[model samples]
Target: MATQIVTSEANTAAVPGEALEFDDIQGLVFFGHGHLKYSRYVFLRMKDGKQARARAWLRTLLERKEVSTASGKQHPGLKDVKGEHALQVAFTYSGLKALGLSPEVMTTFLQEFREGMRDERRARILGDTGGSAPEKWQVGGDATMAHVVLVLFGKDDADLDVFHASHRDCYQEALEEVFIQDADMRQGDTEPFGFRDGISFPYIKGVPTTRGSDALGLPINAGEFILGYHNAYGQYPFSPRVPRSQDPGNLLPDVPRSQRVSGEPRPKDLGRNGTYLVIRKLRQDVAGFWKFVEENSRDPDKSAEENEANKELLAAKLVGRWRSGAPVELCPMKDDPTLGADSARNNHFEFRDDPYGVKCPLSSHVRRSNPRDTLVDDPQESIKLGSRHLIIRRGRPYHDKFADGAEEQGLMFVALNTNIGRQFEFIQQTWMNNPKFSDLYDSKDPIAGDNYDPEYPGDEPKDYTAVVPGFPVRQRLTGLPRFVHTRGGDYFFLPGIKALRYLSMERTP
Candidate 1:
């Protein structure tokens, strides 16, 4: 998450509530201290309105979701109620009831969470959240909320006692208070692998595309990442496109207008309004990563002056951004705290600006992952690529530093789109993990690669490295281990708010 120091003003503006219903819910389980657990549920609304279709999806979900123990038994039983085509996976959380009702049972917990946020606001007011002005952070809060995100971890562990109190404990305490009624809620972080998780996500196709609005950085069409499908009114509004024969289930069209793909000439009775969802649980290796970074960046025989500069440069390239969180495109020569902190300028560059690896290596992680303006040499090509490559990264970092350190600590990368196959995976397999884009398959996402060698750490000889022909001969940064590791993940469809009411009716399968 970009550190934006926002002002502490409650939303006094009376805005209408957005319809927040989905066909399925994908929940991630985070286990920690004192058997504490954290979970995040991503709600998906499907694009179709056929009750049978919704029911079909639920059956498939239950059938495929069985987990057998060593002795072959399970805890949660699968039950099916009709009017299907929606999917939701409920994971463990401590605070479900506290989210809405029963103030007496949860007032104190809610109050504490409120205090934590207020504390953050006060810090912002006192100039602590990092930006010089509120505008520098830019992104809005309501735009950030899409799924249920929670965090939970204990503070007394030997390793955690240090930074836990200093850095992470605040977030943990805030979440606990906010979701106090649900004792099952836990804090959610990035996948433990720590790949700057949630870099690329699919944009919904067809719906109007909002590149950089007041709320979210970019409001892409929902179709681009949901089912690898686009909505019927591509690049247009959805309110006017609904069929005349249908009723708006339990959802109000006046609320958030969620439309399904309905451009094809279909019968008038068809209903449209839903989307898809994908859930994943990825693990990160924090201890091993720090160990590797420390070991590889140092040279045994080289003088400190000779080695230190190269070491720092390589680290910067590996992450594609400086430690200050500034994208290398703008601050090519070095990290610029001012630029990194500027929302208008920080994320606004393509690696093409720095062709020679001077400010940023051609193979920098962020550049390679998001070529941005790099792919197109021509101005028109660059513009086209910008529209296609854009994605909304809505996720946060999760770390239980004091836990056994054997597992769990990273990002919970969440993205919503109409098409999943093309956008999200393309960024992962084609851009981030792909090597051909680099020099002769020499560079990939150093932080996300599965195959790693314990040996060979250092910079490639300048003469040996080659990204271009006769001019810009770049050296490759070697010895860095992949930072993000994928343990497991799955894809599910999130139906719309209207479809949700349709399913609540409970028909026989």
Candidate 2:
């Protein structure tokens, strides 16, 4: 019932430092299937001191991992191509330690990875405050010990059998195969709340992200999402290194002591070809979300027909995009499927023209997630500044009907970035979670914000006011409800093939 993601078998297993093997890196990072019907997230914990076993399993899995350019005339097993699935992997801070990573390399990891998403400082800044602190996370305290994430893709359960048949025994023996989470792809590209997604991804060089040179968005530097390249700061982000004795063969890139960026200097290259990864299990209240919009869209003077139409329009104002995925910037008052489906046009619009919240509201999800050219006066400056905060988000919805067929369903939100501070967390904290964003006061991300703050009376949540010009009175929805909540997630590092091999073969000092 799900669409299958296909790849070629001509993947290169290169050990070259700068040349990244698209095949060795997870396929999910670069590909998405609107028809992908089945997805399984296999969580893992390292067995006690079984480094040898973990490495053995990893080496074998890496050989089979899907590569980037695997299409056209390829392996015989992928005849249908659409029916095949792919598997990719990454490791958390504790997971890396469990695999025998030493303190020296550990110290070189990002603060978010080393300290985790549960860091008290980050919790408060990102609106994870009050009775439900970071400690309330599903994987809190000692439970942050998740080591490996096995991202499995398939059209259905049957497709995954190939993966299990090949590595099940080794996975069980070498590492603890924690519970596997299967993401629901029932609504196609839409989330459970019924909104189309994955529509606007930034085009990056060398990754094969966009189809044409004239794609709506501008192409960004690969370093924005990958390590070892010039980042948004025009400087290479800090890469980890170890003593030459720890990696005598120089399988990794070496940096002299004076070449250090910020952290303490080391000789061996452990941080090269690696990127920071963020994962969050967000639970959504689909019914409550629609109900709130319906109730709030009502007006005594408006006729029933007018109020009925206002339901979707009001929701669009909050989301900054119609359920059809057509951006409100382009179709301010209507839904256009043809435009939404057109890759050439969907992401072509910007917010600089509609500055006064005439079309997309200031607090809308799109504006909050990506302010675009609206954040600054000069369009060129806004584009330049905004590009610095871009992040590659990869999320899949999960749905499991309850006995009443009303169970909780949400998305497995995943993000890729080199600097969690400047890229991912900055957007979440400074933009999405911020109550006052972009010169607007008391407004926040209407769809994904945690508006509850004890700083307000009755610990009551604040409202998101939407302004549509020429309408005279603005539409304000009071008694705002939190439509999404974080259940669990972690920060991990997706090492390059060479770095992954190091994890498998070398025992760092």
lDDT of each: 0.36, 0.69
Model 2: lDDT equals 0.69
Worst 10 residues of 1 by lDDT: 77-86
lDDT by residue for model 2 (249-288), tens: 6667666344575654457767655688888777787888
Error of 1 at 218 (Å): 9.5
Q: TM-scores, in order shown?
A: 0.51, 0.86
Query: How high is the lDDT of residue 488 in model 2?
Result: 69
lDDT for position 13 in model 1: 21
lDDT tens per residue, model 1, 202-249: 223222211222112233343333222233234322221223223334
**Best model per lDDT:** 2
TM-score between candidate 1 and the true structure: 0.51
